[model samples]
Structures are given as C-alpha cells and as structure tokens.
Target: MAISAKLVKELREKTGAGMMDCKKALEACDGDIEASFDWLREKGIAKSAKKADRIAAEGLSAFAINGNVAAMVEVNSETDFVAKNAEFVALVNTVCEAVAANNPADLEAAKAIEVDGKTLETTIAEASGKIGEKLSLRRIKTFTKDDNEVFGAYSHMGGKMVSIVKLADATEEKAKDIAMHVAAINPKYISQDEIPQAEKDREDAVQTEIMANDPKLANKPEKVLEGIKRGKLNKVFSEWCLLDQEFIKTPKETVAKYLGNSKVLEIARFQVGEGIEKKEENFAEEVAAQMKQ
Candidate 1:
C-alpha cells in the first residue's frame, strides 16, 4: 500500500513523533493510526528509559500545605526547562497534595495514591514521554500536627530550595519566618541537642588531626587541647545549627533568640541537585553525532 503525506501528518499530530518516525511507523503498521501511535509510545518509553540513566540534578522542590497538614516533595527532571513546565509543576502539586491528604509512609505508597484519577506511576510515564525527559518523584515529607503545633513551609528560588518547620506556639507568622531561615541558611540540625553523635565525632576527629599537624599546638597541654576542640565544636554548632545560627534578618540575635516563645519541634530542608553529579555536554560533539544519524 502506498503511504500518503496526509497519513504521515495525521500520525505525527496524534503521536507527536518526528516526521520521519511517523512515516516509518505508518509504513510498519500499514497506515494504521492506532498501531502507529502505540509504536511511538513504545519508542518514547524506551528513549525515556535511557534518559533515566542521565543525572537529573536539576528540578523543583515544592511544598503544599492544608491547614495543620503539610507536605513537601522534590520532582526531578533532566533539564531546568522542563522543571518549570506548567504540567511538571502541576505534578508536584498533585504529589504534595497526596502526601498531605494521606500521609503515605514512603514514596511507593505515595505513588499508589490517585491524582486526578491517575496514579503517580502513570503520571510520571506520561510526563516523561510528553516532555521528552525522565521524570521522577524523588522524595516526599509530610507532617500532620495537633492544635498546639503550627506548620510553616517555604519554597525559595522557585522551589530550588524548600523547607518545612513545625512550631510550638502555632504562630503562623513566626513559623513562616523560621521556615524561610531554614530554606535560606541550609541548617544541618534543628538545635545543638539534635546534632548527631556521629557528626560531632567526625568534627572532633577533623580538629584533632588539624592540631596534630600544627607545631605551635604541640606544646599545649592535653586539657588545653581538649578545651580548644570543644570551643571549635561550639563555634561550628553556632554557625551550622538552626537554633544557634545568627538570624539573617536580625543579625544582632540568633534564630533561637528570635523565636522567643515559639519553639521548633521539627525541620526538613531539600535543595535541588544536592548530591547528583551532572554530566558535561559537548554541544559541538553532540551536534556532529546527530548530523551523522
């Protein structure tokens, strides 16, 4: 059967496949539009699977709060452009809403929750194909508190950074301020007391190694060296710990002092592209390879 230009154009419109790919699919399926569409979807899914191996270090970290229930989520895309897409942002909102409403124990449970009558798995697949990139619901954190606790959420830099804090006094204004600080400063712990023993041990070991290599410190007494180490630890906590960190807005006071009667029960922060290593693209080489194809 002879393939018509009209048939190829119709296949392209329905499948969003390239002109050549649509023509090929139409030929392979004997001009059957439905089979051609399926062919394009299968090919797209395979392409997206390959893209899945690519580092998705750029994306948005978003939050949605409903009254006393709050949820935060990070959705990853291969490029920053797709991360800002309206559909991608809507997916983030749906995931956040699912978490806030159901408080799923983990991402898998969250995936099962329906968003607009579709599961997250289907949403991710459709978005991945439609956007021509890998899409992932990377992580989620949800909190539900009693009447005494208030939830504060902040998404900074258009969700490149996100934070959620639980406050004791239910003061929404103060809680939001604290959440903003959490997003901006990137605090490691809510308070000095919350700092992990392993972290303290690591810092002490680093300081000990530094002192060992210093000739001037060799003559210091063991007690004096120990005191110095403690001092260094205190200084680090003051900078890295949330409660002890100097308030960015009011430098004269620490975040703890700024909080006054409102105490932070919990804090969570997410920064996009935190640990994923990105691939270096050589556009010239890429274009050359595509030209060959």
Candidate 2:
C-alpha cells in the first residue's frame, strides 16, 4: 500500500518518530496505523536501550490504586516544564491506571498491557515519537494483591519525588498520614530489617572510623566500641527506618506508635528518574536557539 504524506505526518504527530521512519512503518504494515505503531515501539525500545546509560533525574512519578491492586510508574521527560505538560500528565495517568488494573508483572509486562485499545508499548512509542524527546518509562512497581490491604500514595512538588505505602488495617486518615510522611521524609525502608546488610556494614565501618579518631576515646578499650556502635546504629535507625522516624503528623510519636494496635505493615517504595541525563539549557542558550529558529 502506498503511504500518503498526510498519513505520514499524522503518524509522525502521533509517535514523534521521524517522517521517514513513520512512512516506512506505515508502508511496512500496509497502512494499518496500529500495526505501524507496534513497529515504531519495537524500534523505539531499541533506540531507548542505546540511551539508557544517560542519567534521568527529571520526570513525573505517577500512582494509581484500586481496591485490590496498586501501581506506581515513573515516566521521564527532558525538562521539568515538559513534565508538567497536560498531555504528558495524561499519558502518565493512563500508564499508571493501566498498571493498576492489569497488574503487569514488570515494566515490560506493564508496557505490553493494553490501554485505550492499544498496548502501552505502542502508546509510549507514539508519545516519544510525537513529543520529539527521549520519553521513557524508568520504573514500575505493583503491590501484592490483598483484598484487605489499603494502599497510600504521596507525590511531592509535582511528582519530583513520590512514595507509595502498603498497609494492613489502615484507616483513611492513617493511610493519608503514612503517605504524607513518606513524601516529606523519604525514608529508605519500612524498618531496620529492610535496609540491606551491605549498607549496614558500610555504616558500621564509617562509625568505627569516627570513634577511633575521637579524642575522648584514645584510651577506651574495645568495650567502648559496643557503646559507640549502639549510638551510631540508633542514629542511623532514626534517619532511614520508617518506624523509627518521628511521625509527620505528630512528630512527638514514632510511626509505630501512631498505629497503636492496628496491624500496619508498611511497605514503602520510591523511584526517581533512573537513567536519563537531564539536558541543562540556560537563558542565553534558550534565546539563541529561539532566534535561530
């Protein structure tokens, strides 16, 4: 089938791929727009892989949860302005909702999940192609399905950082509090046990170095090391442990005390843009580029 220029333009608009690429895809798929879209996605993923090493620190973290399922998705853009674009936000919502409903097992599975009568993989390809940027999905996480569990989500400053918490016997108010706390403090884990053993060992090593250099500890025997280690562990625990951190709502109370007898099993997860190096453009550069255009 012959691909028309207008058709190619439409495809280009829909998938920010180059006109030639869109045209070739349309021709390859015999003018079936949807099939052509899948072709673009397969190609986009290939392209994205090459660019994966770049640092992506800017984008939006989106969350969606239904009665029994929940998901958080991080979709990155080149600029903060683009992150706030209504089209981009809508795309994020669509992707997150698709993840919650379908509960795809991984990023690839979620991308394969269908949305708006099209697979997410193709939809993203179409968006990246249209947006004229390296738009990509950085991470996706879905909570374990439990009918009795309640999920909470908090997004700070337009999704720069986001926190998702899964809970047991959570009241609406408690859930909201947990979400708010996670957003503000950005705890590394729900508890000490959740912190990796390697990370703990590193912290211990740093603490030992500090203790050895202390003037007051010059003649202290190894027995003093235990006390110093305990102090260091307590300090680290208060900083990264969700249960140890002061409650955002009360501050006077720990998170564990906030729940009282409520069976609150908190699982907190967060993701910042993993691998897209943000392009930094200054005012002069912006104006120069505009003037040239």
Candidate 3:
C-alpha cells in the first residue's frame, strides 16, 4: 500500500519525528497510522536510550495551579541552552498540568497518565530523542488547600527559582508576598516548631563545642554559656526559619509579625539544577575561538 503525504504528516505531527523518518515508518508499518506511531516510538526509544547515560543537570522548574490544587515540576535537560528552549518550556508546563489535573503520587504513576493517547513515559522518551538530550522528570509536588485558603506562586530567573505559598485566613495579596519571601529566603522551616528534635540536638552539641574552644567563654558560668548558646541558636532560626526572619518588604517586622492574624499553612520551593554538577563549558569562548579559526 502507498503511504500518502497525509499519513506522513499525521505521523510527524503525532511523534515530532523527521518527515523522512515518518514516511519510512509509515511504509514499514504498511500504511497503518497507529502502527507507524508505535514503530517510530520504538525506534525513538532505542535512540533516546543511547543518550540516557548523559547527565541532564539543567532544565526548568515550574508549576501549574487549578483552583485549590497546584502542581510543581522539575524537568532536566543536558544543557542550559536546551533548558531555555521554547519547546522544552512547553513540555515542562504540560507535565505540570498533568500533575495538577491528576495528582499523581510519583513519577511512575505520572508516566502512566496519558496525554493525547501517548503515556507520559513514552512522551518523555520521545522528547529525549526529539530534542537530542537526556531529559528527566526529577520531581513533582502537589499542593492542595481548602477553599478558605489562598495560594501564591512565584518563579524567578525563568524557572531557576519557584515557590508556592499557602495561607490560611490570608488574602491573595498576602500569599503573594509570602510566596516571594519563600523564594528569597529559601526557608528550611516555616516555623521553629517544624525543626526536627534531632537536628536541634545536633546544633546544640556543635554550639557547645564552639563555646569550649573559646578561652574567655569557656570559663564563664554554665548559665552564661547556656545563654550564649541559646542566643546563637536563635540566630540560626532567624536565618533559616521563615517566620523568624524579618520580612523582606518590611524590615522592621518579622514574617510572623507581618502576618498579624493570618497563618501560613505551607510553603514549597524548587530551584532548577540546585545540587546538580553542571558541566563547565564556556560556549561563548568556544564560539569565539571557532570564529578566529
């Protein structure tokens, strides 16, 4: 059977494969469009797997919210340049939408959810081949709140920084401020109570050692040493706990004091390539050297 141009175009649109590849796939599948899709996917998966070992340390971190629910996603690619691609951004957005809409518990469950007849697992693998990079869905987080609660979302530097703040008895305006604060502050805990007891004990031991090392402070009364250690620990809280830090917009008041009667329910943040070891390459320098040649 002859594969028509329409079949090739349809296959190309569905798979984002090359025109020639689509035509060949269609021919190989005996003009069966569905079979051609599977054929192309099978081939793409093999090619994509070859690139899988490459490090994808850079990409976008983004979120999509629908009413009382919001979903944030981190998708990684091999290069910052690819991370900035319009198509890559769209892919991340689509992944976030799926997550928000379905509320998948994990990446495996997320991949089982279909988009336009293609499973997310297949879509990602296909995208890896399409973009010529090792792409990964690092994590997805879902935020759910009551109707009485409001949500605020902020993303900085495209998608290098993202945050979602949930507030109770607070207006949307207040949530936005808190969301921006979370991005800037990068709080480890919303309040001191949330800090683990083990972590506090660890800090206490470290602080005690510091005091012992000081000649003047070491000889001080135990009560005085305890007071100094408590003060130092409070400083840690001021630095790391969001509620204890002075609000960025209003330096005079801490974040908790600025909230007045309102309460912050939850906060979540994502930073793209936060801990990933990025390849050290100066693309500009390379380009200049090439031009000189």
Candidate 4:
C-alpha cells in the first residue's frame, strides 16, 4: 500500500519521531496512523520523540579528514553537559567520518548514508533515545583539495567552534594559521572580488546617502563625493573580505600580505548553537506550576 505524505505528517505530529521514521512506521502498518504510532513505540523511537520539542542548541562542532577530503559537522544537544558526554562525542565523530567517506551533497543525502547497517537518521534517533535528550545533526559539509593544495583544520575550545581552510601553493603550517584566523575573524568572503555586485551597489547607495546628508560634504565637488563613496565602499569590503582583514597573528599585516603568493581556495567555520533560540525558564514559576499540577 502506498503511504501518503499527509498520513506521514499526521503520524509524525502524533509521535514526534523523525519524518523518515514516521514514514517507515506508516508503511509498515499499511498507512494506519494508530498502528504506526504503536509501531514507533515498539521500536523505542517514541522515547526520543517525547523530547522533540526541547531546544537542542548546545553541542559540538567537529571534523574528520581522510587524505585529500575532509568533512565538518555540527550536532546539537539539549545541554552542554550532554554535549560533552563520551557517547555524544563519539556520535559526532561518527557523523563527521560518514560525511567525509560518502561526501554527501546535503543534509538529506547525508542522513540517508548507512552506518552499521542502519540509516544515519535511524542511528541518530536511536542515539537520541538512549541519550535522554533532543539530539540533532544540524549541518554537515565536505571539502576536497588537489594534490598541490593543502587543507588545514582547527578546533577551538574543544569543539565549541571548528574551522577548515584549503590553500593552494601553501604549506600545512600556513594553512593551519589561516584556518585559525578564519575561526576567529569569521570573514564572509575570501576576497573583495567574491562580493556580489548587488551588495556592492547597496553599500554604495548607503555611503552616497550618508554623504548627501552631511553638511561638510554639501560643498564638495561631485567627483570628490564619488571618490569618497568609493573609498567608503572599499573600507566596508575590507572588513567583510578575508584577504583584506588584518591577520590574527600579525595585526600589522593583512591576511593577503600574510599569504604572499598562496591563495585561499575555500574556508568553512562552524560555531555550536550559533543561531538557535534557547529556552529560558523561571524556576519559581515552574515550581508553582508543578505544585498546581
């Protein structure tokens, strides 16, 4: 029997299990919602489902390297303590290894990759059930370098943040320094050339508006005003572009000067719990509510 997406969503809402798990349960039970709900319980996935609503903003950012290929992953847990758990750390390493080995294009494809005869999604669900928290694999990315290019990886604060950089015509030490710089500076683009025309135009407009409203610039010639706008735009790009930013180790020199002839091919950085909105609870209010219950 063919299972409908509506039925799968309905079952997921009722059980709180992963979408793939819910779909499998529905298929196993001939699209019967009640039966699928029971099926998930029997499989012990519903145990983790109970924690699905909890915020999982704390976890580790880790990476794995295999020869010329490397992968990075961020996995979230409900608390920092759980994020440091041996089992949780192992799971993150496993995820990173799987990503590097399979080189999946996206999160969905990465989840479908098999490990120990089980889908990555099922493995995560089982781990979540055992870990007693809402565990989620937030994102994964893979990078590859040519023989002449070198890859550098750095983990800051025991995986609270991680960065990887690929550099062409560079030594491993230089690459590692670049990666560390990337982890600290968090540049948006490798160079000014990578900035989109639209973004440059937007910044140009902003600078023009600021100068137009300035009394000091009102008497300035149009050509001078244009030069000022261009200079302002370049200053903004220098802050956002990696090569223009001052090097962390040597503030006297920009990253571009530090690199000399080497070129940064790619860079990736991940910080745990960067964008997730964490839950804040009032202890007294919670206690009162529990007492009322």
TM-score, prediction 2: 0.76
Q: TM-score of each candidate?
A: 0.80, 0.76, 0.82, 0.88
Name the regions of candidate 1 deviating beyond 4 angstroms: 1-47, 284-293
**Model 2, span 119-207: residue lDDT tens:** 77667656765665667777888886477777777877777777777778777667768888888887878888778889888888888
In model 2, the number of clashes is 10
Ranking by TM-score: 4, 3, 1, 2
Q: Quick one: best lDDT, which candidate?
A: 4
Q: Candidate 1: which pairs clash?
A: none
Screening candidate 3 with a backbone cut-off below 3 angstroms (N, C-alpha, C), the clashing residue pairs are none
Runs in model 3 deviating more than 4 A are 1-43, 279-293
1 or 3, which is superior by TM-score? 3
- Which residue segments of model 2 deviate by more than 4 Å? 1-56, 274-293
Model 3 lDDT tens row, 121-153: 667777887988988888888889999999989
Candidate 2, pairs of clashing residues: 15-129, 15-130, 16-129, 16-130, 17-129, 54-275, 55-276, 55-277, 56-275, 56-276
C-alpha lDDT score of every prediction, in listed order: 0.82, 0.76, 0.86, 0.91
lDDT of 4 by residue, 1-293 (tens): 98888998888888888788898898889988888888887766887888877899999999899888999999999999999899999999998999999999999999889998877777887888887888888998899888999999999999999999999999999999999999999999999899999998888888888998999998998899888888888899999999999999999999999999999999999999998898897999999999998
